[model samples]
Target: MAVSDQIVRWRYRLVPDHLLGEILTKRWVDNAIPVLILIVVAAVFGWLIPDFFSAAGISSLMRQWGEFTLIALALMIVMVAGGIDLSVGSTFALGNIVALTLITVAGWPVPAVIGATLACGALVGLVNGVLVGYLRLRAFLTTLVTLIIVRAIVDMMLLKYSVAIAAGFVDSDLWYYFGEGDVLGVPFSVATALVLALVAHLVLSRSRVGWHVLAVGGSRRSAHNVGIPVRRVICLTYVVSGTLAALSGVLFASRLGGAGADTGVGLEIAALTAAVLGGNSLGGGRGSAAKAIIGAIIVMIMVNGLVRIGVTRGGSSLLLGMVLLAAVAIDVRWLKNRHKFLSKVYVSPTYSELPEAPATSGSSPYALNDRLRPVEAIGLGQIDGPEDVILDEDDHIYVGNRTGDIVRFFAPDYTRQEVFVHVGGRPLGMAFAKDGALLVCIGGMGLYSIGRDRSIRKLTDETNRSWLSVIDDSRLRLADDLDIAPDGRVFFSEATVRYEMHEWPVDCLESRGNGRIICYDPNTGTTRTVIKNLLFPNGICMMHDGQSFLFAETWACRVSRYWFDGPKKGTVEVVIGDLPGYPDNINRASDGTYWLALVGVRTPSLDLALKMPGFRRRMARRIAPDEWLYPNINTGCVVRFDETGRIIETLWDFGGENHPMITSMREHKGHLYIGGILNNRVGRLKLDGMDPTWSGIDSYWRRT
Candidate 1:
């Protein structure tokens, strides 16, 4: 019975074996591929070479490999600071000469020699720092000069001192320990390198200095503007580089038992190779110390094993060069082409509303009045959440759904809806670009355009801001609505970074408004903030008079107008206030009236509850996903008001079995197409008798 139960458990564990296998495969591709290649090479070499994996062999390998690891670390630090130190090899030789001269000529103690050697390294670093940082020289050219100058100094010192094995020199106990001894099964030199590596990792990964390093690497001008002390960070990296190189020189002296002319020769190439192999880009700003260490290890293993297998030093160098070239090729190819791969893998469209309503030819769409009736309800279905609606001159309705899809419906008869674009973020608002493309506001993804061919691509994701950091998905969040000017400039709103779409109500309840309106110029292809610190700005509408425009302040329950031209250019004024409910989509009516949709009705009970701050705070702190604590969607209505902000009419749908939410309204060819965030079907209601002369103009009907 026990055996049977154990078998049952094992079977259960493997019940979802296919899913586990797929997950493991993806994980291997993401992380283990690089490590696996190194392992394979090591294994093949070890199998072919006699005792290559033995303890003695590893000791020899590690001690000799410490210098390469040190160099790689040095390069990594510089790379992180958005610079490079090509003079590390020469500085390393200088360190060895400094230590030897101190011990032999001055008869200094080992500790004093050590201090002098490190200080010498620091001096070299300081020189490099001054040239590149303070002097403002290009890193490549400045370091190149230092590399030659430092090497010349090293050669001059070597000749003057006649420092050879024959010179009266005693290798001290401390030197031997630093060079050859092991502590608790780890080599002392490797341990020292590891300690430095850990310190570098912490500084680069955790500290504020690290962020500055990344910032500088990403863009020097950007870093400078943000007051990151870019010059200091650049200077410090070279200093760290020189110090590390000097330490490597000391390790070299200990390993070889004497300082030689060629103590640090060819190290620059190896360090560069290792850094690139470990995945540090030559371009800088995108490297890690840990990766450099791994790269150094790979190079070390190859050299050591190749020597054991009787490969000449020259031949081994050739192979290392080939490996470095391959890594560079791979990096370049991925950087250039990976976006297409990622887009294809991630962007999936859920639904496309048909063009025009399904033609049920029983009656006229607006039989009640000559004016078409507005949409009574719109169902979100599995995915809809329409936030804005527009109608084209041809009576085609455009709907920007929060699900990130733009659907178009052809009109006269409300039928034939189809998905026009599959934008990969929550799409909020859209308008026709001057060149006839669809300019879309994709929340959390930035501004984008759907070309005539319907290809969705990013436009201006970030504005010209100094303090902003635009990492992958780090910058823009919750872009809500937009309107286009006659001059081809587009103004939009980024609602709040602290709260996303699902959490927007939380932001409203908190009343900590953090929203801004930005303008994007198609001619210049630039986006800038036009107005800052708005309270949940939602819809943006260009005025019919061509002077300025109005935008809905959702939380404040008001509409504000901003003047673009004439005497009051760049000024703002509130046109409407004290809305009865959350104001949503706004459009021009058939009879030159403006229609605004109020998705929910504000009751006195809800208003009093909203005033109690503790209620919302408690709900935010304790509410579960399944919990429901706000207004019921079942009792919502849509209202239309004229340009003077007076109520023209009300469209009421008492939430029940028929329709629940009425969020967006667009008038098309005498008919108003309605949309809701939560509903699953588009609703329609006919007006008995209204204006018949209305045509669906591009300005009046913008959603489609």
Candidate 2:
């Protein structure tokens, strides 16, 4: 290799391409970048102006940023709920007027003044909310009108009472303390802002209201369809925005011991700019209070630094405008092309050279054959991607389809089909619980169960998210397959924590350890991670002895045994490795053996691509998705294995014409029932020596 090539290879190895991808793709990093940039700019300014980092300088910066940060957080809530409050500045002015007038002109107690101020703010928000939420007015237009009307009202009030309130409160001790008080060496206003920010963050991230707000912001129509009270949520967000703005106004007036018409002028623009710069999406559904504070700090640093450098006010305004415009442009572009950018940055795995395999028609032990006989199409054109199959007590076949449904075909020739239940996520693997409920692993939703009446219930949707992960790994991204152990503990496979269900191919390309095995205990109502850092763990099946279960790691083309009881409990060992295809669902055979389905037969081209990480990464970026080479999912076979994990028999659809991609198979009543993800039907093949009267349910639960 050339010296340049060697250097490039070393660089790729040392840094490990996936590390960069994780960092760039993380949401928190996106939110934190503005803060990092602010720090760098502050450092530069400190270098230029030796006093910039002094205690006095820092205190001044904090005092200035306190109210701005509060307003920015208020805007963040509204923006996160897919709305905007253009009237916040006017509301702030109104609040300031209300608090000061009540305290000085009326000689009211401090608590009454504060109450009146907040009440006035809530009333303003209510009006705006009613206009936008109930009247269906555009949020921007409705808030703009509110802004104009409120500003007019505040101006008239100030013109009438501004002089009286200013004189009355000039030497008041209460006003003095509120205006310039310090707590534990921190400015009162700054401390109050920090507390509010912390509370807001908790409400947004940990509460059900926050979830609803995010849902409404993400997609209003969808949120409404899911039974969320969209109008109520929107209204509440505006109320929060208005109340926070009002609080900030009160703080401003108390600190200055006065109120004025221009006190909150231009605050709306500053808050909006700061919120957006902090990573609050103008389009909604994403943001945090912490991010809003960080954005406020960034804006303050730039503005203060420019003033210290003796820039004219107009020039500083121009610079701020330019920065806001640039930040907005960058944010918009990133939101639009985030997925594409992630695809480009993703690093593919490096694989060793694969051993050569025989052709599909070759006379090797793994060669294709005509053992899988064709059967009638079950839900022919109705079901897409019937990935797994199971049988009930009556020999009725149940299969999970691509469209997030479980379709059932009645026994006695298996012709009539009905929708067993709608799961709302791509249903992949399923098993019958001892209580007659159907346990299912939904692709993106999590583990769920369907009762006998077909009512759906969620079991678990999250695990302990790893701190090392760049993305939120709490929610299961791909609950691909699962099986129920004898003790009522549900074991499932989460295929690739880093990618969504639709991005399974990306997980394959990365070939990194991003998958995990999770177990949910019904007795304790707790779910926990059993194993972490597996490579695309797909299908799972409990052993007949109830001591261990076998699960397929699709990307690695291996099956592993996980023991839940006996001396080998909590240990994992490879049962079978280096198969010639990617395995899918595994089920028990009638004769105390197991049946494993290979979804796709591996090919030389794919093997070569896996070995060349650099080539794969480039292909992922440069090639369109449809043009990129995927797994050989067009042809597959079913192979049976003994208790010792040795292949007993291999069955195939020779040309993949009858069944294109076999994913799951179960033996019942002298017949081997088959399912294919891409095929329009389920298949059935007769076992020459099996008993005709033995059903799968009977074999498992009958027990002599």
Candidate 3:
């Protein structure tokens, strides 16, 4: 190979699509970049400008940014978690006015004064939280109304006692020193901001509360359903925001030597601008307190620098607005479109190399015996929400359904069937254990092994981190297609913590991509994440060799292979891509091939959504869910794939013209039985010439 070709190969081996393997992708950079750029720009300009680099100039910058930084940090917490507070500015102004009135006129001690100010702010926050969180008021409107009411109250206070504060009755020194004081070359206000920023950063980055906040921001419904104290978290965040705004107000009053009408005026916009520019998203579930403060600092420096360059205050305001607009524009449009640039300049389309079709086509396929035909449709009327089916020694067919019920179909003719046992919640996938016990994947529960006596035993339900939030209905949303390896280790898919069975499509639009595949070792009885952040991971089937497993990503429309043995163990490979439909329950075929069920085909509209995130996210936020925006029941189908990742055959249901939506398909006694959530009766199909090796666990009954 040429030296240049070798260098190219080395680079590919070194990086090789960084997002594929890394557990944590760098999501925070989009928020951090602007602030970083601003800091660099400011430093360079200050170096060139004579007065701009001086200690006095730097102190001036600190004094200017003091109020904005404090408020922005508070805003960052709320915004990052997918929330907002409009009353921050009002609370800030009120804090200053209240603190001044208490210290100067009421003669309260400093501690009492500060406490009173914070309590007042907290009260406003509590009101906002109650309205937005519990009352289910729209966050934007609820906070807007609160902002008006709080501002009116502040104006009333000002009107009642403006003269007293301005005339120096408040002993200005107490407020003045705090705003201007310095220790060891650091401004007191700057030091205070730093301490608070550091503390907030640690709490958000290192604590579990922070994770809850992010989850809530990402999807409030998902968060609440999954057992996050959504109301409490929302309410408390507002209180924190109000308190921080109040702190900013107190400092501002001190710096100005008196509280005035202009105090904290338009501060809400400034804080929001800083939060957005710093990378705290208005949409939520993605933000940092550190970036928010940096954003505020950037805004302050821009305004201060423009003034230093002889721009009028009016011009500076225009320039700042322009700059903020530009930053937002860059984030929303440029960065997302950068993918187009990458495709054109550096590499070919990464999706072109995926497997296209099965090995056999356009030939008259061989047919199995006539016995398989009617048998395939025999269990149709008996199955409801049937996730998986297995056969036992007594010619009894055991089907695991998601509603925590197992249905039994008497074999030879799967005609006599009854609800075997009610396990509670949803059950997805199942496999026959070596001991004749049935291993089941119970959604909202965990892995379970059922005995012949109709009793269920929990194998493993939890993971290493007990601190990780597991909501009640989803204490464990383990789903479709589990397999027991040779060593008795069980592996399955979490599907999505963001959406339930009824709302699976919502997971696609949210695009937070929080699904993971997990493994449970029976010997150790421990569960670990085999692959994290696979987009809407749906199905998991242990490979034929048992050294690796094949799993499907429903949203990504692809199947991936994860290894558990050898040097390449734990590594994931995209075995197939650009699936024609959303892949569902995967099971090992009797022929050593894998049968994959395509629950729904990807329509043109949904496929186009992959390129437009903002549009999809907006729809998620705005569209009435009952609106039926995407194609549903009509396109349900199934596909068969071999071990080589080739699509061998396709089964089209079209929801049976009113009864499609197939989820799980188990080949039993040379027949195919299908079931899904909304289906009233399972679908059955006869394979005339299919291989006899297609018998699944359900075939054990035929042997018996």
Candidate 4:
């Protein structure tokens, strides 16, 4: 190998250039900016305030953070439901006063005080729900009206009872314990908040109620069209919001021992700031419990930290207002242009070098002829995208269909067919196990099997994960082809971990070594990656000796041998390097030769583009996907080669008369069964001078 080619090879293999784009694609990347902002704010405050991260400081922050978190979560729920709760601050004051009066003055038990306070919140929520949900009143105006009415009522009551409330005190030990208690060094309010946050997260993310809330929030009209009960969902959201906000008030009252005029003033505004700043979407449909918690910490710390530093209340409020404006600005722009930014940066390309194309002339051994022109089409216009075909012991014709089924055409006539099994993923290459089980490669899923009873079993869905990989490569994304060795272990080709089966063309555009070979041993029920940094490894065929295997790297236009036993064990050697077309599945020919499927023919344009990584990168970012240049996969031929990697014969259908883009070919009973991923039917071509009685099943297992 040349110095430049070898350097490029190891550079990409050792250090994955694809990590940056992949990291950006992850769900948590949405919180990147907010997390950074939180870090910067905390650092600045920690520096300004002495012992800001000390035990006492953290304990103090937790008490206030926990209380504020519940209020933020409450507002987040309403905001997620496409509504706002301006009355939350007023309702909170009412709950605080109601709880305090009942406990200290009326001498009510703790449980009764809690119940009455919750009821007060529920009543307020009911009014909002009915007006906004059922009456179709504008949420902002309705909630603002509720805020004023509720605040006015609280003020009138406070004027009459403020002096008496401050003089009263609860003598109950449980009340004091809950108010100022710590469980295992963590404050009771913080512990309770954590528990409630967990429950809310599960409900919003995992339950039907949560899905309904998001659906309604996304679009009320669309949600109602889909029978999602938009009005009911809206009502449920407000009730949850009010109850949680009131619950926070109970905790606040417990700690403070009384309520005042400024008990919950400007709280709704603070909660709203926390919601959007925590990465929760203001447009609804996109929020999480974690986001609420994050927002709460930022808002609570900023306020408390300011007070601790002796910053005046007005100056602190102004700073908070500025922060809220910045948060809203981020929320608006980030939501609008996220995908646009991803489009430009996410389709990252890496440098790759390809060997010069060779030997496709008529005078060369790869000369194309019209052998497939007279090929008899089987199951014409019946099946869909049969990527690979195989014949069982009974000569039953099995072809993998794109509709997640293995369609089998009965033997002899090949007229009758049925869905042998529905695995519910795009099935590709297939092989029969020793126990008559049908092993299949399910694209985007993993390797699966169908036993004699037609029961489906998952062989493996994941391998040992690669360390430092941003994307989880352990989970199988595209299991393209497979073949069983002499041992119970199954070897398979993962075409590309970067792109899915449907996005196979994109993998070609990058043309990077994003593929690998995997081995699954049923004996120990263990799966692991055996080879890495391959260019779209597509085909696997266990050699006749069972000591090694033959695999194809599709984009590299090459075939390679992997030895699992003997002197060459644990090593790979290239068998053919200069094929003019992209090679796919390889199967044994009756006369001790191999049949290789050239799924696509190489063009000079694409071969040039492969070397010009910069050009391909810009093309991907600038051009529409359909307009982007792709290798010619529309037409290709089948090549027959000997054991020593020497070409024997070539089969062609120049105009694709019967089958185009041959992905796999199985030679059985002197006839070759041709399958194409883009073609609708399987083609059967008779061979003049081949073994008529030879069977694919008897080839490898019978010798053992």
Candidate 5:
């Protein structure tokens, strides 16, 4: 290899360029910005303020954070339900006054006062729910009106009860505990808030109620169409917000023991800023308890720190306004452009150098011929994308198609067909178990089987994951093909780990070694990867020797044999290298040979372009997807080869009348059946000088 070639090899091969795209695709990545900001904000404030990290200062900060967290959480809940609660500040003031009046004037018990406070908040929420949800009033205007009405009522109550609240006092242990207690170095309010946050997180993330809330937030009309009670869900979200806000007021009232006229004024704006600054979406349908809590902590720290550092209240509010504006702008742009960014970095192209194509021009072994063009078409226009074909013991033809159905045709005439079973995922490669069970590889699913009784069963959906893999490889992404070993162990190929079944073309364009061969042992019901870093590994066929198997690497355009039981066990060797086209399914021929499907022929232009990864990357970015260069899948052919890796002969569909893309073939009763991934029909060609009694079923399952 040239020095330049070696440099390119190490650059693409060693550097894992796919990691960033993989990380960006995860849902948790959305929290990254808020967490980073939280760290930086804390650092900046701690440095700016004297003794900000002192034991007493930290405890005071936690107390404030705990109360503010509840109010922010209340706002987040309403936002996630596609509504906004502007009256939370007023409702919080109501709870504060209600608690002070009960404790000071009415001499009520602590528990009873708490219940009464919560009830008042719930009553206010019911009014909001009835108007905004049931009456179809806009949330913004309705909540704003309610905010004014609730604040007016709180002002009246405070004016009437303030003198008595300051004059009378009750010394209660429970009230003091709630106000200033500590639990193992954590503040009383902090401990309480953390527990509630955990419960709220579970209810929102891990329960059906949470799903409904998110659904309502995402789309009210769609949620209603899907049988979700849109009005009820929205109403319930407001009630939850009111109840949580009241509870926060309960803590605050206990801490301060009284309220003034200006209590809770402008509190709603601060809570809204905290909620949005934590990365909760303002457009609704996206938020979390963690985000609410993080936002509250940052706000509480910044505000309290600013006050202690001699910054005026107005200056602190100004800074908060700026932060909220910036946060809202970021959330909108990130939502709109995340996928656009992904499209650029996600399809990372790596260096690939396909070997020189063999001479397929006139008089060569692979010279073009219209052998398959005259073949009889089976189930034409009646089937969809039959990717693999097989014969049962009775010579009944079966083929797996893209529609996720296995269609069967009666042998005498191939005109009629019926769906044998629906697999829910596109069925690709297939083989038989010892007892005649049809083992199938389901794309985007995993290995499954159909018994003689027509029962479907999942064999395995996952394998052991690689420790160093950045992305989860345990779950099968696309199981392309499979074959059963003599010991009943099933060997299968996963075409590409990075791309799903629909993105197979993209995977091919990258030409990375994202494919792997996995084996599932029936005896232990365990699956594991046997070969890693294959280039689009497809068809799997247990070699006639019963000790090895022939597997095709579609993009690599080669056939390779893996030994499982012989002396060369745990090793692989190339059987046919440098084919003129991409190989698909490999099956056994009647006379001790192997039949391989060349799904797409190689082109000189494409072969040359594959070696230059930089040019391909530019093409993918600059051109529309349909205009991009793709593998030349225009020619369909099949070649017969021996164990010694010599191509015996080739059959070509020069005109591609029936099999436009030959993906698989089977031989039985002296007739060859062909299947294609892009063709709507299967083809059958009568072979002369062949054994009529020869069948794939007997070839593998018959007694010696």
Candidate 6:
């Protein structure tokens, strides 16, 4: 039992798991709550202020919100890229001053003046970008300094020159159109903001630059490792922020007919509040421009409503500050505990009662015989959790251990032991490629290969995650086992997308189809899913026929065959089902048969719990981890199966003193090599009548 299981059993009873899962699966509903809140607020205000819904009132609201909305959009971009800009308000004021001076005093054409104003704003943003991106300065401090510097410069310029537009331009048609004209019954300023918002939404959600921005914001180190230009993306975000702020300034100056020192004062806080309210994270990597627009509307409504209720300007400002503070606090807490919240609200699969175990009478076919006479203990007290074992051409034995190291034992006497390589994750299933490289499935890191020179490289770690997934399921969570086909293709199993490798038992309790099978081609660098939504698809091994493979679904207690060639290609069929134990690994035996390692034998209580989804859900919530009923992994047995899936011979360590939790067994050169996940040493058993010189590699690759 795990803590998650305990919480599930203790806390929930009345709410069915299926209904809870349905509610939690609707992620879009969470995002829509802000909009719903805004609607409710608007409805309340409209009732209170009879003129709130009138055309005149609506037009006034749009004009007042237009510039702030633009500024909010600017801040939203930086925030989405995992940064922030506090200088937007100052940049806005400066853009207005630049436009006023260039158009009225310099007597420049309106088009050139506008372009120059935007360029200057971009230049300011470029400086911020270089400092924050290239120099690695903190976004908050860098933007704060820029804000002070730009405001100071504007103050000095205002002291020396009057802030006024020329009389000729004040009455200009273009100026009037931007400032107060209407387009299709919508204010030109509002319409322009809407157009920019639409474009920003598309660029943020659909463009490469936007993707890079999000990636960097999500995890800067991961983005850099994946070859994304992290610094450049961060720099571009600041530049975009500056340009948008400048555009807002120009719009405000046009509407007011002149530039003022306080033209954009206090706008930065407003924009930030709006962006945060719209669901933008202060920590970055999540959010949208469209949401920012909605957030801006919410802020504007709050301000307008306060004024309508006869509150003082200062009092309204205080209320807005309080709102921003509350939103930030909620967002931070939510992000930190999102996983815990989701686990409680989702339905896990239910299991039926465990079927009766096969008869194990002394003369029965399923009877366990002690034919395995242990020869010697190899790597004793040196390795931890050698879940799987393999041998090379030179007869060197290799095992992946719990400490994330692949340990190798020298050939012949098999006494000398040394680490071959470190994979930085729990390494499980392994196979030798045709090119002699070692292909391994790392528990949490996905598929990887190590060359002869011991250099490790990642093959793939991503799959198409389901929309209903509560976490980012793109990365393989638990790549349990793998096998290679004759066509040089590597196939592997992701045990459970819903849980990490260590939490495998919890997955058993859920028994949901969260596992998947995937194939990767080394030559073309492509990885794709073969079969999805499986019940803990664990061990995988290519068939002797070379047209199909066998994989065990641990929770389902069944071995299934998947074909990739011949008539049965692209199909799956059950070879065996309703086993007495949960299977872990399947390996080829020397006598044209297969060895299956049962990590745990099923119990009646565990089986009964599986059948009752409601009871299991309650138990998962209420029971303490140490007190809850977990799968019986303490006792296990290995059985040999022929091509027809009929049991041939069974070997058992009933007391589990020699080999507890046998996860894998491989036959080679007249010997059976055994590996256990919880044992300290590897076990080797001698076969009575087999050639002593045979090797596993030679047996599999021999010419037809």
For all candidates in order, the CA lDDT equals 0.70, 0.83, 0.69, 0.87, 0.88, 0.83
Name the runs in model 1 displaced over 4 angstroms. Answer: 1-33, 162-166, 169-171, 348-704
lDDT tens digits, residue span 1-704, model 4: 66875676576567665677888778787678778878988999999986888998888789888888888988889988888889899888888888888887788999999998888888888889989999999999999999999888888878877777899878887887666898998898898889999998999989999999988888888999999988888988888888887888888889887778888898988999999899888888888888888888888889988988999989988888898899889888878887887777767666666677776666888776787898898999999899999998888999988888899999989999999999899999899988889999999999999998899999999999999777789999999999999887999999988888889989988887789999999999999999998999998988888899999999999999999888889999999988989999999989988999999888889887776666787998899989988979877699989768898888888876667778999999899999999989999989989999887888867833
Residue-wise C-alpha lDDT for candidate 2, range 5-80, written one tens digit per residue:
5664566556656776778766687776787778888888989899997998998888778877888988999999
lDDT by residue for model 5 (1-704), tens: 67887788789888877788898987777778888988998899888876898998887888878888889999999998889999999988998999989988999999999999999998888899889889999999999999999999999998899999999877898998887898997888899889988988999999999999998988889999999998998898889888888888889998988898888888888899889888788878888989888889888888898898899989988988898889889988987898888887787788888788888878778888887867888888888899999888877888887888999998778677888999999999988888999999999999999999889999999999999988789999999899888789999999998999988998878898899999999999999999999999998888888999999999899999999897999999999889999999999888899899999899887887777777887887778878888998867999989998888889998866657788999888898899888888888999877788898777887843
The list of candidate 5 runs beyond 4 A from truth reads none
* Per-prediction TM-score to the true structure, in the order listed: 0.53, 0.83, 0.57, 0.94, 0.96, 0.75
**What are the candidates' C-alpha RMSDs?**
18.7, 4.5, 9.9, 2.5, 1.8, 6.6
lDDT of 3 by residue, 223-317 (tens): 99999999888888888888888888878767765766777767787677777788776778777777887788777876677777888977876
Which candidate has the top score in lDDT?
A: 5
lDDT of 1: 0.70
* Ten-residue region with minimum lDDT total, candidate 3: 345-354
All candidates in order of TM-score, best leading:
5, 4, 2, 6, 3, 1
What local lDDT score does residue 551 receive in model 4, on the 0 to 100 scale? 96
Give me the displacement of residue 672 in model 4, in angstroms: 0.6
Across residues 1-704, which tens digit of lDDT does each residue of candidate 6 receive? 55755554444333334455545555454467579868987998989999887998888889878878889999999998889999999999998888777767777777887799899889889999999999999999999999999999888866655534535355367865776887898888788889999998888789888899889989999999999999999999889889988888777777776766777787888889899888888888888877788889999998898898999989988988998898898778877877676666554555444446676666866676555435357888988999999998887899998999999999877889989999999989999887788999999899999999999999999876667655556789999999998888899999987777878888887886778999898788888888987889989988899999999999888888999889989999888776888998998887778889999888878887776677777776676546767889977688889767898888877666677678988877888888888877788888776667776677666622
Model 1 scores worst on lDDT over the 10 consecutive residues at 346-355
Ranking by lDDT: 5, 4, 2, 6, 1, 3
